[model samples]
Target: MTCSEPARTTTGRLPGGLVTTTRRIRRTLAAGPRVVIAAVVKALGYRLVRVQYHGTLGEADGAVPRGTTVFDDEVPAVANLDPALLGALREAAKDAANDGVEFFVNSGWRSPEYQNRLRREAVSRYGSEKEAARWVATPGTSPHVSGNAVDIGPSEAKAWLSEHGARYGLCQIYRNEPWHYELRPEAVEHGCPPMYPDPSHDPRMRQ
Candidate 1:
């Protein structure tokens, strides 16, 4: 389907928590005959298994150290990002490069496995899964796993980008995570939920 085509089928809740339009259910039925019966049954409100994030599978170990660098231990695969957003990020990076600001992609996409590993490690180190979940969003909840979010900043370029990033279609979601930005448009009317919401007034908003 084209990008302009509506991605979501359901407008309201289904019998279970599943939500989708009758048209989509029918289409799926017609396209995959073998699974048609099961699909129809699922359409009645059997929630589909939560999609596992597959983006972080190939990430190098210790790509991002535990230090306070802008990078995250896991990120979504860059290939999954919208083409337009990816182009915009590259352009933004190039612009920064021209200004003599060295920037790198500290984190991009993350797979479910990577997120789970981080979660496990956090619990092991911090002695609380709750603490781990707080610091790192549970797999599916992470924007980095969407491949549309990135953290960017130089040791000194933070201030400059803070003033100019929006021009490149990037916005900082959390004030505390000054290095993190995503390709969310100023005005988004359709498609999936934004990777990052505007930071809240709470000091712990980023975490």
Candidate 2:
């Protein structure tokens, strides 16, 4: 029997080594969509360590300072999101507050680098990229990186948003991730579009 080398050893760093790393990424992706995400995170150990110590890669990477809220306009994670998305979240939060439900920003805008780290970590925790897709997404396709999505928290807040969000253009994007939401202005009149089962089911992720 033969053993394949660990994926990490096969990957290389940038400035001169991306060629090898990128080829590995291509080969892993070509194998199947499930393994594709593992390749993207193979060489991210150092950056992931930096993220752990600093809690972020800094404002340039759309890192939300700890304890960020929907109203924290000064935080990059809140400020960097699409203005319309921010507006909708703020509006929904205000109403939710009236119901004794305060919205906490678990995640908002993210730099592509941060998104990649999350995918890498998810893959590690879940034991495979295929399962990770149920939670995290690749940087290129993550709504958070695009500033179009937010992950709110607190069971009460999620419940409040689930019931009242559409009136303000905030709608949960995935059935499995009830805390995740995106702005859809038309929802105010027509209601939100159907939810995707998970990130993998969203057609946008393929791109």
Best by lDDT: 2
lDDT of 1 at 129: 61
Determine which window of 10 residues in candidate 1 has minimal summed lDDT: 66-75
For residues 174-196, what per-residue lDDT tens digits would candidate 2 score against the true structure? Answer: 99999999998899999999999
Residue 205 CA displacement from its true place in model 1, Å:
12
lDDT of 2 at 159: 90
lDDT of each: 0.56, 0.82
User: Which pairs in model 2 have colliding backbones?
Assistant: none
lDDT measured at residue 194 in model 1 versus the true structure, 0 to 100: 36
Regions of candidate 1 where Cα sits further than 4 Å from its true position = 1-77, 187-207
Candidate 2: global Cα-lDDT? 0.82
Point to the candidate with the largest TM-score. Answer: 2
TM-score of each: 0.51, 0.70
lDDT accuracy of residue 6 in candidate 1: 32
